[model samples]
Each structure stands twice: as C-alpha cells, then as structure tokens.
Target: MPITRWIRGAKLSFARLPIRGGAPSEPAYIYRDPWKGDAEQGARIVSGRFLFERQEYSFPSGRWDQGTWPEPAQEWLHSFCWLRDLRALGSDEARLTARALVSHWLSYPPTDLLVKNASVTGARLAAWIANHEFALASADRRIQQKFMERLLQEGRTIAAFLPLPAQGWKGLKALKGLLAVALAIPEQTGFMSRFLRYLPAEIERLILADGMVAERSPEAQFQAARELTEMSIMFRTAHSSVPPILETSLDKVCPVLRAMRHGDGALAVFNGSRELYSSVIDEVLAQGARQKLLAPSMSQGLFTRLALGKALLIMDNGPPAAEGFDKRAHAGTLSFEFSYQRHRLFVNCGSAEVGAWNKALRASPAHTVLVADGLSSSDFNAEGRVVRRPAHVMCEHQTDGTAHWLETSHDGYYPPLGLKWTRNLYLGGEGEDLRGQEIVEGERATPFALRFHIHPDVTVIRDDEDIILKVGGMVWRFRQKGGQINLENDIYVARGRVEKTQQIVVESIQYKISSEDNKLQESDEASSKDSLSENKEKKKFSQTVTWLLERIPE
Candidate 1:
C-alpha cells in the first residue's frame, strides 16, 4: 500500500476504537423494520442454504462468511439485512439463530475491503441498530457494548463521507443508515447535527426536479422512497419534526413512482427496475403522504403514462440518463409497456440485482422496441457509462380526454445505418385498441427487427398472420404488416428471479424509402411555397410498419 493508503487505513482503524466522548451506552429507540421478509427465505437460511443475488450456496452451520462463496452472496451476508427474514419467522429458535450469527460477525468482523465498503458498513450498522431486540437483546453485556461501539464508529464514518459518488440508490441506503443512528441514539449530538447539515444538498444532487431519480430508474425511485420513509419514521421515533426538505423530497418522488406502475400495483420494469412485491409497495405508500396520480400524459421525467378504463401504458421517451447517473441505465429508448387491469400483456424484460442476467437485459433487444442491425439504441462502454445513445429524442404527446396518442423519433440508428426511427402509438376504444406505427427513413434498404416481450403469465398462440394472447377472461390480438413473426423462448427476471416466457419478434425486413414516398402530401401542396415546414415534410421519405392490439369480442 502507498503511504497515503496506509495512513488512511490507520486513521480508520484508530477511529473504530471504543466510541468515546462521554455518551450513554443505550439508544433512545429501536425502530422495527417496516418491510416484511420472505418466510421461505427464513427457512432456507435456517437450513444452511444461502440464496441471494440469484446464486445459491450451501454451507455448514455458522460458517457462511468463511467458505468460498459468490461475491454478491458475501456482500448480502455482511450487510446483515437478512435479519428481516429471521425476524419474520418469529420463533425463539429463529431469534437465537440470528443472535448467534450476529454475535459471531461482531466478534470476528470479516477482514475484506468489501466488508468495509461505506455502503455495506452503513447498511450493516443500520441493520444492527434497527433489529437489536431480535438479534442481541439478551446477549452478554460486553457483546452488546461492542455492537453499539461498532454502530457509533460506522455512523461517524459515513456521516463524514456525506455524498458518495457512482452509488445512486445505494448511497441513499448509506444515508438511511446514518440517519437511523443519529435519531435512534440522541446522545450522539455531533452525528445528528452533521446529518442534518449535509442532507438537503445530497438529496438535491441525487433526485431531480420532477421527482424521478437522476439515475432514471423506477427501482431506484422506489428504493429511495423506502429510505426516506425510514428516515421519517426515525424522526417520529425521536420525537423530532421530520425536516421540511426531507418531506418535500419524499412528496415529489412518491407520485412519480406511483404513476410508473402498470395496471398492476407494482412498478413498471424500466431502466434497472423490477416488479417489487405490490403489497410492500402499498405498505410503503400508506405510511407517508398521499401520492396523487400523475397526469395521463406528461413530458416531465420523460416516462409517459396513458390510461383508459383498465388499460394503462408507460413509455420511455427520453435518452439514457446523463453520464454520471447512467450506470444502471438501459438502451431501450422509445420502448413502452402495456397492461390491462392487473395483468401485463407486453413488457421489457425486467432487470436483476446482479450477474450476467443484468448485463444481457440492458440491451435494446430485451425491450419492446425496434433494433437496427442488432445494435442497441444505446450501449455501455467497459466502465458502464452510456455511450452511442440517441442524440436528440423528440416526443410529442396528444390527448383529448377520451384518447391518448404519442409520436416519438430518435437518431440512434442514423449514425450507424443512415436511418432514423420514428414510432406513433394511439390508445382508444375504451381500453381495447392499441395502434402502433414504426417508420424508418434511410438512404437505402436496411434490415431491422421489432420485438414485443410478452409477460410470462400471458399465453400466446399464432394463427397465420394474426397473433393472439390470453390472460384470464381477456383475449387480445396482435397483427402486423412488417414481416414474418416468430414466437421465441424468453425469460422474465424482473420479479427478482427468472421464469420462462416468450417474445414476438418481427424478423429483419429489408425496407427502402423511395422518391415517391418522399413526395409532398396534398396538405403540404396547399401551403405557401416559402413555408419551411413544407420543405421539411418533402424530405420525409420512410418505410412504415403498422400494427394493432384489439379485444376479440368475448
């Protein structure tokens, strides 16, 4: 290690020695975890099978952190949120199991750099503080003091770090932990005041003006809400007023997150988001302020919502998030999801927590959008920052209270294939009709494919040129004029695991825009010759594919 690194490490180690400054040993509050955990997970943990981040490990008793393990599973173990699962089991044996694991962890504290990661440490500290009753209330006095001392040390460490970079939502988790410590133990006057000092600017930098996260993810939005809600609960537990700025930030975010949900109560799978349990989402929403639904059509946050009767749709209309926040961003520009009532019909394959699945799902092919020559509309470099994304995305939304329609265009393919992509979507017929038109304007014949990923719960069948989907009592048809349609095997990973599903892919059709196609329409002919709009319209030559979804009268 360099001298600087050694000195920094020495300072951090010195900082951990028995938190002093004459504060009381006991905390003022121990708040319960607001979210529930899986009883199945609790059983698996007790059985010595550790399942996390889509990887499973079977270890002998009490040696979870000792053996060779997947990196993510190790992080999960050290972060210590698994206590929720044991607490959910709600048995004396379960509590003792937790106590044993926690006690061993506190004593031996894993000696890896990842274990000391600020976010990991923050989360572990918060978990230890929040669930002390179940984890160690009856443990020996020395063990209890050691736990508090660790909490105090980690609390001050992250409080000093303040805003973390490249950690979008995970950074908030760290802050959530810091806030938990500050409020739970009133004696750490410095920790409480320091937390209040740096909060507003951090929230402003992370959250955008319109309530969406800077990362442009529905999952991030939901997680950020959970963090803020816990902080609010912490304030209430401490008998202090929730900071006005904190409440304001929460209010801005909840409505936008609520509007992103499909007809199903969970969030729509966009960016790095997945379908979190709807019950938990409802629980999170119920605790804070009432979130009024956003407008059926909007440009802010660039995710448009349209609903008529039971049919609802969310479309991504913006480019990938600007650089620093684009780590979890996807390249599915102009893709949309559709659902009816509580059932999803079309979706983008949802994202995962980690591993190859997440990387594979980030490309444009995993979404319901057009791909030119199998290239992503946006792609990440080795560092995972977005590069080669659509340069200027234009979306025009229109509605008349009874119908919703939008026109979107992007230059994502223009640079590589000399083609520009435009899509038009219309929803009408009291939630029964959905029409889409895909137009590509290019110099020569270009091959492209359009994909629509169907939900695993929806059954699909092909009948000649028309396609059919059935879920519950509702039946819908998909018909297109583009090219051959094939139903291929796929998988849905957004519900936090993988399940067999299928996708409808319209194979590459060679399309060319001819001179006649660029001729002026009669409406343009009537306009004055000096009109700039007329000249622009004359250059718009394109090959178009139109499709529709309508209910087959049951």
Candidate 2:
C-alpha cells in the first residue's frame, strides 16, 4: 500500500476503538419502518431455523459463531439486526430470541469486510436504533446495559470509518448510519453537532440539480428519498427543525420518482435498477412533499417520457453513466420500456435475482433495441461494469402540437464496425398508435437483430402479417415492414423469481455501406440533400426497419 493510504488505514483502525463514556442514553424510536415485517421469518429464527435469499438453514442448538458463518449469511445476519421480524411477532419468546441474538452478535463481531461495508453497517445501526424498545423489553438490567454498550461501540466505529458522502450510494448510506446514531442518542452533544455540520452539504452535493440521484438510478433515488423522509420525521419528533436543504432535496426528488414510475407504480428498470416491490415505493412516496408529476421529458435525467391517454413510454436517450456511478449501469443505451395503463406491454429483459444471470440480462440483445454484429452497444463484464461505453449518444425531441416524438442515436459500435443505430419514435395524441423506425449506417454489411420483450402476464399470437397482444382486457397489434419477426422464448426476473417469458424478435436484416456513403457522411449538409434525392436508391443499400403498434378493440 502507498504510505498515505497506510497512514489513513492506521488512523481508521484507531478511530474505531469503542469510545465508551458509560452507556449512552437511548432515545425513543422516532422514525417509522416503511417495509413490511416478516413474522414467519422471525418465528423460524427463534426456533433455531434461518432462511434467506430463498435458502434455509436450521440451528436448533441456538448458537451462532463469528468467522464460521458463510459470507452469504453475513448480510442475512444484518437483516436480523433490524428486529422488524422479531417485533412483528410481538411475543415474549420472540423478544427473548431477539435479545439473545443481539448478545451473540455483540460477543463476536465478524472480521469479514462484508460485515463492515458502509451500506450494511448503516442498515445495522438503523435497525438496532429503531428496535431498541423491542430488544430491551427484558427484566434483566445487565442485558440492557450490555446492549447499550455495544450499540455505542458500533456507532463510534461507523462514524470513524464512514466514507465521504461524495462516494455515491454507499456514501449516502454511511451518512444515514451517522444520522441514526445522532438521532438515537441526542445526549451525545459533541457527536450530534459534528453530524449536523456535514449532513446538509453532503445531501446537496449528491442530489443533482434536476433532482435525480448522482448514480442515475431510480432505485438509488428511491433509497435516498426514503432516508431523507426518515430523517425529517426524526428531527420533527426530537423538537429540532428539519434542515431546509434536506426538505428541499426531498421535495425535488418525489416528482422525479413519480415520473419514473409506470402506471402500475413500479419504477422503470433502467440503468441497473430492478423491479423491487412496488408497495415499498408507495411507502416512500407517501413520505415526500406532494408535487406535480414529471413532464414529458427530463433533461437532467436524459430520458424522454410520453404519457398519452392510457399509454406511457420511457426511453433512455442518455449515455452510459459516468465512471464512479456506472457499476450497476446497464449497456442498454437508447433502450425503452412501454406500458398501457397498469400493464407493461414492452420491456427489456431486466436483471435477475442471481449474479450468474447478470451477463445475459445486461447484454444489448436483452433490451428493446437493435444490437449490431451481435455486439453489445455498451460493453459490460460479468461484474456489471461498463468496460467500454459509446462515446456519443444524441437525442432530439419534436412535436407538432398533436404527435409527440423523439429521435436518438448511439455510436457504441462505431469503433469496431463504423456503424450507428438511430431510432425515431412517434406517439399519437390519443396514444392509440405507436410508430418507430431503426436505421443502421456504416461502411460494411452489418447484421443486426431487434428485440421487444412482452410482460409475462401478456400473451402473444401470430397472425398473417402481424402479432396480436392480449392483455389488460385489450388487444394491440405489432407489425413490421423491413424486418422478419418471430416469437422467441425469454425469461422475466422480478418479484424475487425468474419466470419463463417470450420476446418478439426482428432478425436477419443486413445493411451494406460503401466508400461513397462514408465520404458523404463526413459532409452533413451535402449528404442531407443527396440522400433525399436518392432516397429510393439509398434504401437498396441501407437497412431500414419501420414498425407500428396500434390498439385493436377486443
């Protein structure tokens, strides 16, 4: 390690050395838990059975040892620290189990890095602080004293090693832990004031001017909003005024959150966000200040949204997220998701529950866009990082007071094949008609495939020249003019399970480019005139796929 990093590490180690001033006073739980508590999971844990991530284990001897637990189980143990499940059971037996679990955890702190992760530690602190009442319902004063001692120790450790709040989602979470510590032990005068000094500025720096989170993820935005909401409530309960900047951040974010939701209230599965439980989203939104829904398009978010009658469309017109925030970013630039009222009609095959399924879901083919030469537009590795992203992504929106549309293009395949994918979308005022065209241009013959995934609940049937979509007591038709369409088997990963699904694929379309086309491409003004005059001849060489989606009465 470098000398500076080594010195920093040494300082961090010393800083976590359990600052004890004899058991800090515990404040009452002020923030309400937004997530649903699982009583069944609590019952299982109390009975010496543990289940997590769809897997189960039993420990009837009722003992858990540090260093022996599997890496996967550490996260599960953190969830147990929340005490939501135990609180839900509301029984003396469950209360005893909770106390014993906390005692065991304090006795043997895990050395694993996962246990010390900023996000995990923040969650542990919040859970422990919020559930103090349930955990300390014991008659033994010694047990209560030990819990407070350990809680204080954990708080100090977290504050000492907390990452800078500019570190994206993890940083936000670390701040959340520090805030919980301050709120839970207001008598810690120095610590509470120190937390207030940095909290407001950190919140402002991470929240973008347009209200989107710095990571450009809907999921992270939701988590940030929820944290701010809790903090606001805590401040109010403690008779302290909520920070104006914090309140402003929450107000600005709620509309963006509302704009990102589908008609069914589920967030768009864009960037790296998955389709988490919709109810949790509802709870978060309920806490924010009410605001108008987002308009048709957001420049800061770099996405176009069109709400026409019952149809809602959200298209990614932005580039891949920048470096530090791109870990969970997907390679599906220019991809989109569509819905009719409460039912999703078109979507990208989203991220799955397991890491093993990441490569397939993150590939360009899984999105509702054209993949050229079978290469992903944005290159991603197995770990979901953007190894290489397109250098440029351009988007333009135009409307004629009735028809709304946006045109977008990306240069992801420019280096390898000198090809670009351009898509134009048009939606009718009534949203009864949706139209699009894909144009592929380059110097060589490039093979491209276009995919359109349907929601698992919807069924598709092929007619003579089009595909029929049946869902939500309505019918719609999918027709193509320049590409062959087929029904292919697919998988939908959401709601904690992977289910068999289907996708409509347009394939085997090749476009050939020549030296003349390349030279003409260099002069934009001259090429525009020439291409219009030679439109028919250009079609012979260029690949153009035009399609239409129209509502059909049942």
Best-performing candidate as measured by lDDT: 1
Candidate 2 segments exceeding 4 Å error: 1-7, 18-21, 25-34, 47-53, 56-73, 79-82, 162-167, 290-296, 381-383, 513-541
What lDDT tens digits, residue by residue, belong to model 1 across residues 1-554? 39856766675666565665444466667887777877778878777676876777774345445767756667777888888998999888788888877877766765566645677777787787778888788888777777677777778667655545556767767777787777666677777776777777678877877888887888888888888887887788768898998788888878877887877788899998889878888887787655565633335568888889889988999998887788889998999999999999999998865677867899999999998888888878976788888998999888898898899999988888778899999999988899999988875567788899999999999988888999978889999886767889998988877889999888656555466654544445676767646465445445778889998966
Candidate 2 lDDT by residue in tens digits, 1-554 = 49856765675576456656566544444454545677998898888777654556664233343434444465657545538888888789988888787777666665656545666676777777667667765437666666666666666666665435345555655666667777766666645665677676677666777888777777777877887877776677668888787788887787787788888888888766767677878887776666555633468778788888888888888877776677667778898998989999898777743346666777788788888878888886655567788898899988775778888999998988778888999999588799999988864677888889888889889998799999989899999988888999988775446778888888755555555755555554455766655643443245888999999888
Clashing residue pairs in all predictions, respectively, total 0, 0
My TM-score estimates for the predictions, one after another, are 0.90, 0.88
Predicted candidate 1, C-alpha RMSD: 5.3
Candidate 2 TM-score, true structure as reference: 0.88
Question: Which candidate gets the maximum TM-score versus the true structure?
Answer: 1
Residue pairs clashing in model 1 are: none
Computed on alpha carbons, the lDDT of every model, listed in order, comes to 0.79, 0.73
True-structure RMSD, every candidate: 5.3, 5.0
